[model samples]
Target: MSLRDRLFGRERRSAQTARKRLQLVLIHDRAGLSPGTLDALKDDLVAAISRHVDIDASGVHVTLRSDRDKQRLVADIPLAPSRERRRELG
Candidate 1:
């Protein structure tokens, strides 16, 4: 790592991902949910949504957001472009 990377923490993407995962685990534990529960939920959501719409499953994100006194589940699902849209862009 260069001095700039060291100074700016630019090479910490994997560390950041790990930290986020740990935070999710802590949140899940506090919420009385098993660590695997969120993964299962994400899978279920992808399946249900895929039945009705084309989605980029790989890009789907399902996470729990915790604020001061509230916690909320957030899902960011990316939809695939329709054939017409793809053709237009092409």
Candidate 2:
């Protein structure tokens, strides 16, 4: 380790962990929901989406991220091809 790492190791403060933990707190506060609530909502969304569409559930990424002036619920869902697409190609 370098001089900086040695000096910081005395107290063992991890900047990355602190930043990520604070971010999680802020996201839940801004969204007015706990992390568990967010997880429940995500599950509901996945179920609803899967009922009518084909998607890669494991590839979904959901988070509460900040926008310009407000917090937003962001989701990245990977969808499989639909019948309409196959028809168009045929």
Against the reference, the lDDT scores of all candidates come to 0.87, 0.84
The reply for model 1, stretches above 4 Å from the true place, is 1-25
> Highest TM-score among the candidates is held by which one?
1
Clashes of each: 0, 0
lDDT by residue (tens digit), candidate 2, 1-90:
577778777544578679989987988897898878888988888899999989888888788887666898888999976789989999
* Candidate 1, 15-63: lDDT as tens digits: 7889988987877777766748888999999999999999999999988
Least well predicted 10-residue stretch by lDDT in candidate 1: 26-35
| Model 1 TM-score relative to the real fold | 0.70
Clashing pairs for predicted structure model 2, backbone only: none
lDDT of 2: 0.84
